[model samples]
Target chain A: MDKIEEKELWPEEKSLMKAEISRRKFITSATLAALGLAMTPYATLAAAPSNKPVNFASFVEINTTINGQNMKMKLDPRTSLLDLLREQLGLTGSKKGCNQGACGACTVHMGKDRINSCLTLAAQIDGKEVTTIEGIGSETEFHPIQVAFMEHDGYQCGYCTPGQIMSAIKVLEEDHAGSDAEIREWMSGNICRCGAYKGIVEAVKSVRDETYDKKLIKRTQQKVS
Target chain B: MNPFQYSKAKSADAAINGYMEHDNTAYLAGGTNLVDRIRRDVTHPDYLIDVSELPFSKIEKIEGGLRLGAMASNSDTADDENVKNDYPIVSEAILLGATDQLRNKATNGGNLMQRTRCSYYMSPHFACNKREPGSGCDAIDGHNRILSVLGTSEKCIASYPSDMCTALAALDAVVQIQTPNGGKRSLPLVDFRRLPGDSPEIDTNLKEGELITSIDLPESSKAFAKASHYLKVRDRHSYAFALVSVAAALVMENNMIKDARMALGSVAAKPWRDQEAEAMFIGKKPSRELFEKIAEKTMEGAKGYGENDFKIELGKRAIVKAFMKVAGLS
Candidate 1:
């Protein structure tokens, strides 16, 4: 892991870190006040502020189940789910393309529904289940969707592959991959700047067809039994 | 992003009080738009009141129609059996917007409260009157290919960018709001959003600390229930804002139009509905020619900005297309 030394901090970086510390201190005092402690601690801290200007906001502790693992983390109220996933949890499989909802590169599963992690607040996921691309499959074994994408050459740059796969899995789960047109419309949110949409669509269709055939085989076997 | 105080409100009263106690406080639900705006530094609320956990997430069938809770996810509402079977236009409109991912996170009230996607309004680099009142609007002469043409004022010309709201306007839905004083009031969807006028900063008629509770859709005739349609023409097939969209519902009796409701989007500050044009269809036989005439009447006084002049024609065709679809002509 890369670490930044205190002496190597840039002028702006140092100021930002100072502000962050002060903000954390203020949050600690505010939390105590909310717990029936007197507000004197918060008032004194606000009045005794140091050289660096600090805009203190409350920090929220979120208990979320990510990748089937229950974890609790204190997050700034403004932290987005994408930042919490990549920066704090070190799960960087979900790439941030456009932080705005315009691009779906940061797609992940919240329960059964896929959501743009960049647009979702980290605090909003309290007590919710989050599934990132890393959780979709293991390094030793690939999910069928990942294997299908590899077999069909579904990506070029691979920057958006994680989001594409996440969205595709949800597409099949939602029963929206019934036809080529349906696949295209359902997967339209995850944009591939490489213009590998033709192969992407082919991969999704192949998975859908394979899954359907397997279902048929299982049904026939059940009937025979 | 600017740091702001955050609190999770346990009840509706707590949410309202949290907002009213602060000068610049915003209710947080879904956070799809509010978070994005905060990241861009376009909106800087001093405090955030989390209302996502409030008991406003149900979609129930009322005595007359459907009542959609404010916090109900757009995907759930669109996929509801009742909405899909009875108000399919609303379902179609909701599905046409954003994506499956956005629909899952976006709540009904959040969708209604979403700000315009106009480049000038969203980007802080440009002067946007809607962002900073009296600062001046750069889109008035700047790049306005996606701005509104109807109901635009010189002060601002941002288009309302919600497909669900467009359908709600055509459906004559009512917005239920919880006043700060613990009172409740209802406003029709059409009257819920306001025109740009001089104060473009004010997007809706919602007052400070007034929380949107639910939206109610009134019962309509079977003809309207069966013959409603939403048509959106955009730069792409999906995941794009509408260049011009239309939501039309009609009731036909004996080959004559008995009633009609039409509302347009991306052409005004709010859903642009021409009641006069809708009234013109009553007692008249539905035809392409009549639809064209009605479209023309609806586009009257629609002055477009330089780049968006094509919307005048595109909006007309979209209205006609929607009408044709509802009439089962095409």
Candidate 2:
């Protein structure tokens, strides 16, 4: 929450700032030996130059909600959403295959729509909601799409499975998976290196058909009731 | 990615001011293209002013036609009822591009500002005039299967890989820009992108700190709207970039062509449009012979490098196919 003023610190001041931290740590034990002033950890840290700045960049505070959980962190401006998820939050479910938009292994939901997290800057998604694979399901209870993938053997190597499932859920939600061909066309961004096209298509198709049937039955039940 | 100062702009003026204050600054919208290049180290900016929150995310029916705000996502624009009905070619072209997820994040202005996808231009290991002014071009002799065949120069052969721009060209769209000096100007979409002349580094005619506010699609007649198609030929049926794409719109009256507009993509530095070729279609009957002649005329000045020589024939076939589909001949 602390906003540090970003201005270039002089060389002597930078070295003195570094020494001041070490001297403060040493003085914490030798309190009675010297100037007789005790400083708390917070006070010592706060004593450092509040306006200390780098050459051009500084840490940025990104406030966002991830999988319904509110999160706030100070991150480098260059950090991407994928890196924030995988490295910072330890949400490794989103694989970093290419780290580019070409491969959709790092797909996640930015609010209601899915996007390539690798291409999304962490700071840019400030105040936005992000949903990753961990948010979709856990080992105890799998999402319908995850269950379908398991039943249909939607993956071989399984590196691209998370992204595929995320995209597949979006495809059904967007009403784009009317058929196997349509599913493949819509899910083209997520590439399966093992070439598990057959199973992926089958998994998406099964879920799409089942979801449609469920809605149909609900309508029928409503009419009967 | 290099470190940069990041700030979100609340308004167009704020964004322009932020951009003007920094020499090496980029406006962040969608971040699909800019962030990708930043990660690749092909582009380095000292400041990134986030303009995604600017008040430019509207798609309204204007007096003449549609006015699409620069920040409107490609997905929203493509799925809009008015766009799908009135400008089906635009919808189809946007849909034919990157996958569903990408369309969700990619904005209309960002799509127009997409840099070339040439391998040499993207990788720092290779020399690209577009990336570095005097570095020389490796794509001229390297694997340039996807490079431009038209509107290329000795300095750069990178193709402008945007399907939406091709459709915008056919629709006669105009780009509305907010200049740094608090002025506004509009330019035709065809003139918005510059050909790879001596300065391949300059992609568009836009000046520094000039923010694109919106794009205006002029209203077309009922016939032109009805008979329009965006045909994209690619290595894969799905997310791959187009090998050769064509956006064709024709107005026909009683099996005779009344007006025609055609634009080609993936074969030029800019969206290739030949007025002479389109003019040949006017006043002519809808026939295979006329379509073939128009296709040939469109490919008149197209010169291909060794690896991309197939694009010439592919472009010709794509033009004929798009014309036929729009004319409802086949």
Question: Which candidate number has the best lDDT?
Answer: 1
- Alpha carbon lDDT of residue B164, candidate 1? 97
In order, candidate lDDTs are 0.85, 0.83
lDDT of 1 by residue, B253-323 (tens): 99999999999988999998888999999999988999999999999989987889999999889888888
The sequence of per-residue lDDT tens digits that candidate 2 reaches over residues A1-225 is 122222332222222343454555443423422343321111122212224344434678878999889988887888899999999998998999877687799999998899999989899889999999989864445677877787778899999999998999899898988877888889999999999889889888888777422322211122221
- What lDDT does model 1 reach? 0.85
Best by DockQ: 1
- In candidate 1, the residue pairs with backbone N, CA or C atoms under 3 Å apart (3 or more residues apart, or in different chains) clash, namely none
Highest TM-score model number: 1
Q: What DockQ class does candidate 2 belong to?
A: incorrect
Query: lDDT tens string, model 1, A7-122?
Result: 64322233334446555554554355447553221113212223433344378888999999999888888789999999989999899998888779999999889999999989
Docking class of 1: acceptable
Off by over 4 Å in 2: A1-57, A138-140, A211-225, B221-223
